[model samples]
Structures are given as C-alpha cells and as structure tokens.
Target chain A: MFKGKKIIVFGDRDGVPGPAIAACMKAAGAEVVLTVTECFV
Target chain B: MYDPVIKACSHVLIHTPSFVRYGSKPSREIDDSTTPVLPAIETHLRSFEEAVEYPPNQVFIGNLHPDRLNGIEQPWYRHPVEDASRYGAYGEIMPEEEFLGLMKLADDFDLMWIEKESAPMIKKSLQAHPFWNNSDLGKIDAAVEMARIHDKIENQGSLPLYCHGRIVGCMHRHHEKDDALKAQVLMENLMAKASGALALTHLLKKSDIRADEIDLLLNCSEEAVGDRYNRGGGGLAKAIGEMCGCVSATGCDIKAFCVGPIYALVHAAGLVKSGLFNKVVVVGGGSMAKLGMKFKGHLAKGMPILEDVLGGLAFLVTGDDGESPSIRMDSIGKHDIGSGSSQQNIMESLVLKPLDRMGKKITDVDRYAVELQNPEVTVPAGSGNVPLTNYRMIGALAVLRREMNREGIDRFVLEHGMPGFSPTQGHIPAAVPFLGHAIDAIKRGEMNNAMFVARGSLFLGRMTQLSDGLSFLIEKNPGRKAPN
Candidate 1:
C-alpha cells in the first residue's frame, strides 16, 4: 500500500530482499531511493 | 537546576515474540522451498499464548496493577521458557500477520510479499491498529498471486517467511554469489531493526519528546548493519534514527557484549556535559538469535520455549531539570585490564572501590539494578534467579565489610533488592531494565540513590580472559544543592 510513498533502505543487495522489496514497492508506485550499504552509500 | 540527568524513561514492545522464531535456524522441514507449511510447529507456538499474558506484563510497564510482578510466587517451576503470559498478551502480541505488515512499512521496496490468503489478514490487522492508521498499505497493490509468489520463491525468493506453517511470504536474494546478502541474514537483521525502530518510536511518544529533539541515537542491539567489505561494521543508529524522525541527528553503533547500554550512558552523559550534545538517547532492540536461547532445558521439562519476547529499553539523558535524577559523575566505575576476574574481586572493583572513592558505603545506595532477568523464565530452564543471586552477593559483601551482620543480610536484601522482570535478552535485561521504575521511585522521593551496575564477558570474542563492568549512580536531584 506504499503508493507514492518515499522510501529509503540501508542494506539492499543480493541475499537481502531489500532491493527486491524496493523494486516491488517501486512497481507498486512507492518512490524507492538510497542504500547505505558498503558499495552504495 | 538543570544537572546532567535523566529527564524521562520509556519502554516499548514488538509483542510478536517467539522463543523459537527466526530465519537463520530453519528446521529440516523448513530448510528449503517446496515444503508445505509446518502445522505442528505453529500449533506448538500458538499453545504458548497463555504464558505471555501472565500478571507480570500488564503491570509490567505498569499498565493496570503495579505490584503484580512483586506478588507472583517465586520459582515458578511449573513451566519453562514461557513467561506467565504464555500466549503473549493480546495488547502486546501483534499476531504474525500484523508483524509482516510492519515489516512491509519498514520495507522501502516491494520485496516483501504475503500470500493472497494472508494479505487480507494483514490488512485487517493493520486497519484495526492505531499505529497503522496512517499506513500506506491500502495505497499499494499488496496481494501476491500464489503462482507469482511461488516463482519468486523458486527463482529469487529463496528466503522464506513462514507464519502458521504456511508459505505466507518470502525475502529474496538480489545477488548470485554465496557471500552476498543472504536471505537468512536479511530476515534476521530486518526483524531486529523493525522491532527496535517500533520500540524507539513508542518510547518517543511515551516520553512525549519530539524525535527531532534527540541530538544522537545509539543502537545497542546485537544486529550488524553493513555490507560485504565491512560485513561486521554497523550503522543501525543512523537507520533507526531516520526511522524515529531524528531528522537532524546522527548516530553510531556501540558493542561491548552486554555492558553496551551502560557504556553508552557514560558516553552520552559525557557528551551532554562536554557541550557536544544536549539530548541523547541510548536504545537497544531485542534479538532473534537470542530467541529461545535456552530451548533445550525448557523442552526437557515439556514447557513451551519461553524466550518469546524481544525486550528493549529507551531513555533520555538531558540537562537535568533539577527535579529529575542526576547521574553521579564524580565516581563512576570502570573495570580495567588488571581488574581480576574472580567474583569477589570483580564485585569489589566494580561496586565497592568506586563508591568508596565517593565516600559512599555499600548500604548507602538505596537500590541497585543489575541482571534483573525474570526468575520464571530462568528457573524452569535450570538457571536460578539471577538478580537475587547478585543481590545476595552484594549482601554477602556488606557482611564481610562489617556493614551488616549475617543475620541482617536477608533484611537488607528484602529492603534493597527487587525481583527480576526483564526478558532474558542478555544485554536487554541488564541494569537498564529497572530504569523506568527507578525514575518513578526517585520522582516519588522513595529512593534517594540508585546505582546501576553491569558486567560483560570479554571471553566471548576470544580476545581477552578479562571481564568488564561499569557502574554509575543516579540520585534524587538536590535541587539547588548541587551542580552535577
């Protein structure tokens, strides 16, 4: 139900559904942005 | 009148506690995809409902009866692991479905999915709660087709989320490598963060202090928030801070086995005194790894796994308002490398020396907060009442020092000691647990001074044979009598 909601995640890579969850949320219209993990911070 | 002291104390819960829950340790039946839901396990879990609602919880945060925990019979050997509310209080137990919804809200992506069957249940749960009134779930298209969910489970959704033996949801892996963010690790980390964040927000509300007022945040939970290169490095502080709406705040993680919160308190107090920050919060989340940490002993006695709840604490130490309790900065205790590891030596170094330097006696402090783990949770598992043991030790010390005769030890304990009420979440149950109650006592002038003492095993990391501890005193504000 996150339509139009802006969201940010800390760790979002393989093994963690963070990216997938973010991608799904984005597909559902939430504005997904930012990752604070090692490579992406 | 504003001394560097605690202004308020608050505690919150996630409620969806389980003794044998978590993704990392899956059973043979749940080890991989393609398995049907494990009905037996869920049934076993649900049977525990009765244990969680016991007299302790409601009065616990002191909602209804304040003396329930004090009145309950000791050595509740009737059961193992489960607290009295074996089934977790309805007020606290946020049913599995509801918890998934929370996990979703905290999720920035559509990576979380509940079966079409479970989605409605989650929705109903979310709609019923005040905490979810402003949620965006209704705005999102949440129900996932089983076929689609199955595909995700088979291909990318390797990390599964189970509720009541059903494939309710799955956490996916975004990488092809083995060392990447594993679904197992993700689930564990997310569970801790979500729970901790919820507790933190609840504390902010309980204290009626705006989150933005917090200048710093610290996550003393056992979870690590990092990536491959720095797998063990952490930043849960910043993540939880942002979630708590500490907009201008920046935070870092602190770890020292179980003594973290005490160390964090000393550091925060120093920060407030140093003029680097005005208001600081030291918060910790419960851990999944610690869930059912004592399952074997509990099960040996046919009791449900009791390590159900993930307990957490949040307290604010700001410029003392002269009326609130001030932290005694004059003689805080710290265990040095030379501090011997024996019980007597440790106690002397940790409890006595510091107080002596401050010209205080063992009996001077009105109350002492140490390992207050609930006896009910520990006794059934063969571990005796921890807090009482600590108090008895102190009483013994008092006797040796000629402060009290052996006969007076019991009286001293009865007057100064308290039953353990905290969950056995190691660090979570340490001295920090009594903070809320201590704040209440000081405000009512029932206690003039309370010393919080905590010890941690350095042997866990295999780096040192030494034990570590720190002690700090909080006392009734002397009004204009002192500047802390």
Candidate 2:
C-alpha cells in the first residue's frame, strides 16, 4: 500500500507504534513525513 | 497528522477452560454418545486457581444465558452459533476433548493460564434454578453434562485450570423476572465486576504502576445502558474507577458487537496519543443471555451444545516502554461514509488508505490477524465471508500494491491473513487474540510488523450509519538502530 505515499502518524502522547511504524513505512518505500504527538491540554 | 513511530508493544492472552459444551439437539441422539467432550472450561479454571503468581479474585461473566433471556425473538435463535449448530450442519458443539484441544491450541498460540472454579458456581447456582426450568432442565442438564466432560479430562491427567482475571461482576437477564428486581441484580453484578477489575488495577499499582498513574478507563460490553432518553457508556466505567481507586476516570463504551476489544484498543491508543491518558484500563463484562441458543441445532446434528459458557475480560493498555513496542496509535484508520460505500471502498478507507498514509505496504507485514473467530460458529448463516471483511481489507492493501485486483482479492486475503480463530463471543475477535502472538513475534525477532484490524456493524440498527474501525501493529526490526 505504501508504493509512493508520504506517511504520517497522529498519535496520543502514549499511543503505540510510533517508531516501529515509521521505520516499517520507510522500509516499504514511503517517505516518512512526520510523527506528531497529540498532547492533551 | 504525525509520522508514525513505534516504540514497544505487548500482547497477553488469558485462557479459560470454562467454555461450555452441550449437545446440539434437546433430544439425545445415538451419534451424541460418540462425540468427545473437551474439558476447556475445567482446565482453564483450574489453571487460574492454581497459578502460583496471579490468582484471579474477580471474574467478569461477559455473556451468559439466564434460564431465560427477555426481549428477543425465539430466544433460542438469539445466539448465532446456537442457531447455526441446530439448524445448519456447520455448527458443531465442541465436545469436551475438542474444547480442551482448542484451549491447547490457544496455548500453542501463547495464552497463559485458564480460570477454573467459576463454572462450578455457575453450574450450581442457575442450571437447576426455577428460572431456567423451562428448557426442561436443559440449563442444569447441560452444566452437569459439561462437568462430566471435565471429569473425563481430569481422569486423563490434565491439570485443572482457570483464567487469570477475578470474578468482579456478573449480569443476568431473565425474561420472566420483575424488571425492578432484574435491574437491581444487574446493578449489583456490574458493581461486582467493576470491583473485581478495580482490585486488579490495585494489584497493577503494586507491580509497575500506581493507582494515580492510570489515566483512562474503558468499559467494553454488549449491554447498552442508560434511560430511553440517554443510552450509552454504562455505569460500570465510573463505578469501576471509583472502586479501583483511580482518581481521574470516566468510562466509555466501545461497541463493535464482538469486535469491541480491537475498537477499545484503538480508542485507548488515540487517548494515549492525545496525551489524554497515560494508563488505560479496557474491561468487558459477560452476558448470560447468549448461552445455549444453539441446542436444537447441536442436538439434531449430534454436535455438542453450542452455548456452554459466558464470561468477561479486561486489560491494561499503557505507553510502551523501551522493552515493548508502543501501540502506534497514529497509524489507525476509521471508516467514514466518505471513504466509499462498496466493500472495496470500505476496505480502502479502513485499511489501505491508512497504511498508505503511513507509507507501509501489505507484504511488509508478517501476518495479518483480523476477525479471528472460529468459523464453526459463524458459517451456518451462509455468510461464507464472515471474516471476509478483514480479508478484503488486507486484499485491498495488496491491490494498493498493484499485486492483485478485485477478482484476486479473495485469494490474496487467504494467502496473507490468518484464519478466523476466535470464539463466537462478542469481543473475542477484537484484537485480543493477536495481541500475545504479535508481541511474541516482535520479541523473538521473527517478524518486524503485524496488523490488528477490527470492524463493527453500526448499520445493524439500520440508522444509515456504517460500522467500521482499523488498527495496525508495526513491529520493531531488531536489526535497526534506534533513532537518536
């Protein structure tokens, strides 16, 4: 699915799969776009 | 949107032998004598009780059949598995031996201990009670039959087992009972279940976390609570939080029918990603109305009884530390109607698009575990594609990769995804089944990533709403270095 798409993950502060997803997506040929952590105010 | 990065993950499975086994038909047939009983319920219960480490003091019975369940058409047909077993050839009551074999299979898949003693209490209390007397002593008869099955297993040198979670609460609905009395009993049951879960939370506090550390509480169940005016988020959540000593907690319900656990995981992941909660407790109580709905089918086919047991489950979803991969909440996908209405579109919106956005391909995942319910329970409806929703989603991922097309999606799914291996219970298919296996794979360095997808049918109400949700697991490659 990640042929040429740019990947991004919007996550809760404690959400999982942050680094692993990024690395896997990168390996699958998608450019790692950004990993933003959604902080609760 | 943020770039997805996974730190660590852990999946744990609590096995119980308390699964129920009864003949399909109410009448005993010659073939029924040949069916072997599997002592799944007994073995699991015994394991829980004998465990040297964590003995469950609280148990949550998720779905049980009160001698009678109210407000349903042909209460016997209420449980799909029971219907399939009685009317269709596909539904087979898991004989005691087969039931134990399934539990053993779970062990092969990495489930820990099974819970034991609870079933005896259930068998003793309700089976022979006047409330369940209508089935011609069917309820108690089934319980006694299952106990006999357990005896056979014990004679074979199998260890008695129980699941790890304590019996905190229970919910029972008798169609014939007074509404007020039923409500009172249900409330007490809920409180007990919540208290049991809370006690576990306290135990957790003494282990690696503290009471104050828990940030979110999730109550997962099929029961839709609230007055006709306001129905959602049952009292179990707040009550559980209060009983467990969690100071800041609000309960929310995740209803995906049986896939509530996966949805709960995804929701918990979102809360964690949003910095809203550090520690989230996801809990589910049991439903008794779901029991023994398939006896006729089972009896006709000479298969074991289909509805044998009802129980609840709970888990602690937290931030991944250095030792485990985090939930990777940022990569989740939702099924909005805008994603398209066809099966293809639904799959794309729920699975493909999210992964594409994450820049991951289908082949990169070691295994795709979605809708892992055992087919014996769901196949009688001629719904051959019961788990096909998940398979189709995975196929869409393959199609997105240009490796397959509409016609090939089915084959692609068969090749990539695991079989439907969960029980017919509501939350069994929820990502819980894959949690332990996924974590173990990552730890063993055998796989680098896996996908956990769960879907729901919000349309069952015919409100024009679509039921859908998706979550994937990206395991850490041991060969890769940490990004500093």
lDDT of each: 0.66, 0.45
Query: Model 2 over residues B361-429: C-alpha lDDT tens digits?
Result: 776666677665444444442224346555765676677669667788866665556555444455545
Please give, as one word, the docking class of candidate 1.
Answer: incorrect
Q: lDDT per residue, candidate 1, B306-379, as tens digits?
A: 56566666678887676888997875888776654446666777789889988999999888887767776777
Residue B143 CA error for candidate 2 (Å)?
22
Off by over 4 Å in 2: A1-41, B1-207, B210-212, B227-233, B241-250, B256-259, B293-296, B380-385, B404-415, B477-484
Best by DockQ: 2
lDDT of 2 at B364: 63
Model 2: DockQ against the native?
0.02
Listed models, DockQ each: 0.01, 0.02
> TM-score per model for chain B alone?
0.87, 0.58
